[model samples]
Target chain A: MKKMMYISAVTEALAEEMERDESVFVIGEDVDIDGGVWNETAGLLERFGAKRVVGTPISEGAFTGLAAGAALTGLRPVVEFMYGDFIHVAMDQVANQIAKARLMFGGQAKMPVVIRLCACGAGTREGAQHSQFLESWFAHLPGFVVVAPSNAADGKGLMKSAIRSDLPVVFVESRQIYYDIQDVPEGEYTVPIGKAEILRPGEQVTLLSFGYACEKARQAAEMVKDKVDVEVIDLRTLKPLDTETIFKSVEKTGRLIVAHDSPAMCSIGAEVVRRVVAERFDYLDAPPVVVASKDVPIPFNDELEDYTVLSVQDIVDEIMKISVGII
Target chain B: MKKSSVASPSAEYFYRWMLAIRHSEQKLKELYIDHKIKGALHLSIGQEAVPVGVCAALSDGDKVFSTHRSHGHYIAKTHDIEGIMAELLGRATGCSNGYGGSMHLYNYEKGFLGGNGIVGGGISLALGAAFSAFYQNNGQIGVTFFGDGAANQGILHETLNLASLLKVPFLAVCENNGVAATTPVEKSTSETDRTKLAKAYKISSLSADGSDVEAVYAAASKAVAHLRAGKGPFLLNLRTCRWEPHCGIIKDTRDQKMLDDWRTNHDPLNVIAGRYPELLSSELRAEIGREVDARIEAAVAEAMTAPAPELAEYKRNFGV
Candidate 1:
């Protein structure tokens, strides 16, 4: 048994991959001396030295490209963009180069790189500039594997698998999950990417979410237990999504509700709806519903920000509405 | 940065690269005029010293990732003239099977990783490649090249911050020609000197005369040497001149005059070829020209003979 937290799980995952594969290493801001912005990589520099745990210049585009080159040259690299939004700067590296290199090059190249991004808004008073959920932006890309684990075990196992996968992986970790601890085995383990875990078994309504939203969804599941049987799905990997589990659950339950902190329009939610509507249209008793952040920039004020985002009450209320055919 | 007198043999190679690129420019311009090529082209007519100087410092194992303006990088790293030409011609034999056009040439055998279309995009990826170099314990490095316009991109600065803070063994070469689209570097950037921005990362940094082959070579050589000796990531700004009207054609006579003046008076290849008439006639020069023309003709023929990727084949590339 291990008592490691989510952040520690992330560190262990990277360290394990680095030890397991000679071609695996890490680079990002404050990763060497400070052990990364979130302390996930603490003590990594002392063990790996400056070469493997490389600190970079303030050139996101250049370093992102560097990582892609490294990935192409047979290295499995995990690069951290301190904030999720900062990934936009290195969009060329992730979306254009690393994501498209394999397909664009006619399968002549293999891009096995992991990009780690810390998404803010974990009930921390960090303001709008620092707090925004951008997983939908990356989920829109085809070649990328987006991982966001809400639990400690999934964080370690999924990250390890991401580093090992023969594709560009973007691991989105929630700031809320750092100290969030759960039971985990000390033995080596790997969680498969592109598979959603059914956290709770139910028969009335299915709630889909990942990362921080999973916890809220679980809470909403409890809140609506007497009202309806709400099945909760932890969609750890956003891209190359496990639509099978979702659709299967929706087919059985005849109702679906997607709950995430990200925006609604043109979001991962949109893709999920498209997938279900395309394949399992008759399964839905009514139009599927999505509870998400408002379609606007995340505000600075605490109350407004909270109002803009989804909560257990909001999710439970959405479930109640679906139960009563109110929506 | 290392400064040298203009009479070195390496200087000749640099100048020749510039001239060959110019020839490519002239050919591309004529093609555009003849309506043989489509899409907006971003030519590297005056930026010869950058690719030649930096690539000269790297070995075959060290990889290079480039941008939409990538013809110079393609030529600098390898001799895939036919493949590149076919790509420009939108032939099935093109590097990307005519799917990527000019912005996605990928030649892995020669360590040319990719030609990306996004600005400031491939930097982290290059750093990742260097990370692999460091992990594999390979005596190799990854060189990622971008432009001055890319500097304004937030990712470029973030990548620098991470590379410096992490000490990744990647080298960043900024070919600053003072333009991002129609916007000049001075107007867009509060600090026109990009090297200073690199220095803020507190990593090893330098700026060089990007137009001068010898200068860029010296600076890049030192950085590569530092990388070879197990130093961290390094940043270098190449202060060069762009001798084309962005690419292909220009309606502005002033732009045309600038392009013409740069082509005629400041041709890097002609500068060296003029200096070394003996070397100019040497077997190496003959080999380069012959190789270039033959490859170009082969590509044109291949493109003309081949079929476009059929609709049935679109599923292969499009991931439908």
Candidate 2:
């Protein structure tokens, strides 16, 4: 059986990596003392000492910057930000220093820095300030390897790869998938970043999704199967995106639909669509579609938030509309 | 454990370093006035003693972290005024290869970790460097220099707390030049005693007169000793005056008389050097001017002549 929540997968990944690499450790706020805000980092602190399982102050920029500094110097630091929103405070460290350090120095530095964040605006009534789909923002940045894992298996596998990878990696987790259970093999299994997984293969239409949107895409693909054949591809990693696979699928089916939980405007979906239009324009029989959340504030009320967020049916309906030419 | 005076030569050297920095700034101010320089450059005119005193005491293994107004720290740490000049000029031969201009000077071999552009940004970064020094068991002491404005940054206090709690072998210096930008310290906070704040983190903290070379040197010596003895993080608040109105081409004129008075009375280099009857003025001034001019000239020439970083350079990444 696979674990459900993205947090649990992250926990399993951290545990396994810490066991493997002596220098690997997690440093962040409320991580050791409180087992993390979402209860993802539970019990790892007890296993690791105060030295390894560092409980830092409210200074997100410091600990994150500290992790980058440590990674550059010697140790492999897996720094966690409680929310993706707080990354803005440490963007200078993340962008200018950490991301560009290795490349800026003409490869003299490795920058084995793995920055993790509880990402995506999944509806839990957290309101506007707390919720934002910031994956695309990082994906746009050069030298930043952006990862958005969907299932439990990918979480541990991708994280392990992130720690081992020489480049700077941003391992973002979907808050909505932390508790969701899926069967993950009980041993060490590494997932290669930049490889997109084909969840379900079909011929009529191709659906690109990742993170929380994977669940919706799967459901939508299933429901619209009788009407149109749906091929769902989970882009586990956004940067170093499996563009070859995405374009190949587009070549086969001559149709594509991109969906993500982030705001639709200037998002990954938009970028993907632009790339498809520019590179693979001749392969498409019709304009490639996108199913994403509205460009507005994520609400505090549960129902309103749910209304704002994507659903399996929404993906299905949007794809069907494009396929059927109802819109 | 206690304050001690720097050697007579060391005190004189401090004066020389201060003069060099001043002349460098004067040269740059002309450039800024001439519209040759781009970007905001924060010059450390009065806060010279902190870097000179601290760098004089630290061994080669010790690391330095500095704030936006960081030319003095970089010069004090590396003593390469030429690299600093090329850097401020944004020349290709400059440290960081002209990628990081005035505020982001770096020379890891010299243990000049960086001249950080962000205010109070380098504090935690220094803590990590200190942690590396600890983990590597190199006994390397990390010192991060911040402006009085950076004291108000909440992250700095947090890092101080962590550094103290973990007993990280590091030192934090707050160059309290009475102002954070245009706002004076009196307007910034009611609690004038910043040393008390560091003490709250259980780290040994003290306020010292930043202008006098002896006073700053004595405080830095004690602070560095405590850190070297495995006593963990230490804080030193330096109360100095910005001899220039923040930087060249000043707009704000709040207290011109007070500022003028400070510039006249608190000549930091002179304050310590003047008290020494053993030193002669003409000889020292001649030597100082000669060295300063040589440094400034070499740095500018190197920067101006150096090739710019190729546009193709940033496109490549490290291959595994």
> DockQ of candidates 1 onward, in order?
0.46, 0.36
List TM-score per model, in order.
0.84, 0.90
What DockQ would you assign to candidate 2? 0.36
Q: lDDT by residue for model 2 over A25-124, one digit each (tens)? A: 8888788877888887888988877777888777777787777667756788888888888888888788777877654443455678788887556687
Q: Which stretches of candidate 2 lie over 4 Å from their true place?
A: A1-8, A34-39, A85-111, A119-121, A124-133, A141-143, A180-188, A300-302, A325-327, B1-9, B252-254, B279-281, B317-320
Ten-residue segment with the worst summed lDDT in candidate 2 chain A?
A101-110
- Which candidate has the highest lDDT of all? 2
Which CAPRI quality tier does the interface of model 2 achieve? acceptable
Give lDDT tens digits, candidate 1, residues A64-124.
6667777788777788888887787766567767778877775678888888887554356
lDDT per residue (tens digit) for residues B103-170 in model 2: 77787777777766667777877888787767666677778888777888776877887788778787
lDDT of 2: 0.79
Ignoring the other chain, what TM-score does chain B have in each prediction?
0.86, 0.92
Q: Which ten residues in a row have the lowest lDDT in candidate 1 chain A?
A: A119-128
State in Å the error of residue A312, model 1.
Answer: 1.9
